[model samples]
Target: MSRILAFIFRRRGHGRGWHWTDIATWIWLIGGTILMFGPALWLVASSFKGPAQLAEFPPTLLPYVQQTAMVEGYDAPLPLYTTTQEDGSTKVLAEIRRIGVNSQMVDPGNPGERINVNIADRSPVREIGLATGNYVEPLVKNNFLRFLWNSVFVTVMATLITLFTNSMAAFALSKYRFRGRDGVMLLIVATLMVPLSVILVPLYSVVNAMGLLNSLWGVILPTVATPTGVFLLRQYMLTIPDELLEAARMDHASEWQIYWRIVLPLAAPALAVLAIFSVVWRWNDFLWPLIVLSQREHYTLQVGLNTYAGELNVQWHYILAMTVVTMIPVILVFLFLQRFITTGIAGAGIK
Candidate 1:
C-alpha cells in the first residue's frame, strides 16, 4: 500500500525526469476532460435510444445495439399470435427463450413465469435505434425551427448593438476626457452591483410603456448596453497609446475617422471576447424573452424548449436532443473566439 501510494505520488527518476507528478497531471487532465464532456456525449447518444433502452437502470453509452433484457413474467419465451402463410396456413410466432438469466447484473430477480416457445419461429433481432424523428418531431410539432431562428436573430442583433453602444461609450470614456466623466463611469459601473431582480418590475413597466411588449425588439433594446462590456472595452482602450490618436489627428483625421479606422481595428480582440459573451447571454436568455414574447410563434429557442416540459412527465428524449442542438452554436462561437478570450479579459481588467 505504501509503495502503491509512492508510485502514484512520488518522483520516479533522478533530476525531475518523468516524475510521478507528470503522471498525476496527465491523469487529472484526462479525468477532468471526461467529467466535462461525458454528460454531453451521453446526451447526444441517449437521443438515439428507444423507449426501452432509455429506462435501463445503468444506461448504456452506445446506441444502435440490441439490448437483451430479461423482461418481467418471462423465464421462457412467450408465444405471440401466429402469422398467416401464403397458402392461408398458420404458423406459431414465439419470442426467444432464455436458458437462464439474461443480463444477470442488470436484473438478477426480474425474470418471471416460464412458458414454452419454438426456437425456429423467433424472428431476427434488430439494433437499438437512431430515433432521428426526435429532432424532426419537435420542429414540426411545436414550430421549434421558428423559435431557433428567433433566437439567432435576437442574439445577433443584440450582440451587434451591444458592441456598438458599449465600444462607443468606452472609447469616449477612455480617450476623450471631459467634465464629470469619472462620475458618469462610476455611476454606470455601480449598476453592476444592483441585482436585476430588484429592477425587474420597473424595467418591465418601462418596456410596456414603450408599447414594445410581445416584440423581439423589446428583448433586444433592454440589453443593448452592458456594463461589463463597457468596462472591459474601456480598460482595453486605455492600453492604446494616445500618441497614435494624436498622430492621426495631426494628419487631419476626423474624430469619426479616427474612431472608425484606428480605435475599432485595435479593439477587435476585446470585441471578439465581448461578442462571445453577448451571444451566450442572449442565446440562453429565457426569462426576458418568455415575458416579452407572450405569443407562441414569436418564442425564442430557449422558451420553445419549455414546451417540452409538462405538468406531469417531461419529454426527456426531445429535451435531450434539443439541449444538444442548443449547445452547438455556443460551442462553435467559443471555439472560434477562444484564442482572444484570455487576452481580452486579462488586458481589459474588470474595473
Candidate 2:
C-alpha cells in the first residue's frame, strides 16, 4: 500500500523537488473530492448507527454503541459503564438503574450487592458497532421488492421510449428539410423553460382521461418525451454527415433502413448519454409517481420510501438505508456509461 501510494504521488513531470503549484493542485483536488463525497460518506455512516447513537449531541462519524453485560440474576442485559472512584481508580460496572443524578450499579462478577455512583463520574462503555437491523428490517417488513420492481420497470421502459422518440425527432430535425421544421424544433426547445409544476394539473388530467392513473405506465409515459433529450440528440445528429443518408438512398435503402442501420448506430454515444439521463430522472422521480399511483403495491421506490415518514415520527434509519439502496442502480448506470458523456456532449454542439 505504501509503495502504491508513493508511485501514485511520484514526481514524474515536475523537477527534482515538488513545486508550490503542485502542492496547491493536490490540495484543491483533495478538497474537491472530500467536498463532493463527504455527505455521501456521512449518509453511509449514519445508516449504520442505532437510534441512541444517532441522537448524540456531538455526533460521531463511526457508529458507537453502548456496551451491555448480562448480570447473574438479571433476565435482560444491563448497560455497562466505567466508573471513577474517589481513590482515582476506574472499575467496570453494570448499571442496573438510574435515579436523577446517581446510578445503581453492580459488579457483573458479583451481582449480589448494589453500589451507588454519581452519574457524572461514570461514562458509558461503547464500542464501534454497525446496526445491520436498519438495513434488514425494512426489506423484510416493508414491500421493498415490489417497490424495487416498479422503479426498475419505470426506469428501463422510460429510458427505452425516451431514446426511441427523441432519436426520431432529432433525426427528422437534423436531416429533413421541411417548411415548419425549424418552427417545430424551436417549439420543443421552448418547452424546456416551462417548469414541471406548471403542467402537473393538466398532465394529471390527461393521464386520467387515458385511464393510466394508478399504473406504472402513467408515471412512465408522461416524462419519456423530454425536451433536453430531444435537443441533445438533435445537436448530436446534426454533426452526422448528410452524405451518409444520401449514399444509403442511392443504394436503394428505405427511410427506415437509413434511420435504423445508418443513423442510430452512428449516434450511439449521444444515445448513451440520453440513456443515463433518462435512467437517473426516472429512478429518482417522486412527485409524478406519488400523484399518480395510489396503491402501495404499485408504488415506486421513491414513493415507497416516503411511507417511512409519518405525521409525528420519521424512520430515519430505514429511510437512509433504502435511500442508499436506491442510489446503487443509478451509480452503476453512470459508472458504466460515463465514458461516453464527454464525447457525446462535445460532439453534440459541433457543426
Best by TM-score: 2
Pairs in steric clash, model 1 = none
Model 2 score (lDDT): 0.88
Model 2: per-residue Cα lDDT over 1-351, one tens digit each: 999977877788655787888789899999999998899889989999888778788989898788999999999999999999999999999999999999999999999999999999999999998888888888888888789999999999999999999999999989999999879978997887776788999999999999999999999998988988888888888899999999999999999999999999999978888888788888999988999999999999999988766425877888888888888986786678766665655755421
Give a tens-digit lDDT track for model 1, residues 1-85: 9999767666645656676778889899889999998888888899877665677788777765342444465574343434344
Error of 2 at 221 (Å): 0.7
- TM-score to native of every candidate shown: 0.75, 0.77
Which structure among the candidates has the greatest lDDT?
A: 2
The global C-alpha lDDT for each of the candidates, from Candidate 1 onward, is 0.76, 0.88
Give the CA lDDT, 0 to 100, for residue 225 in model 1.
87
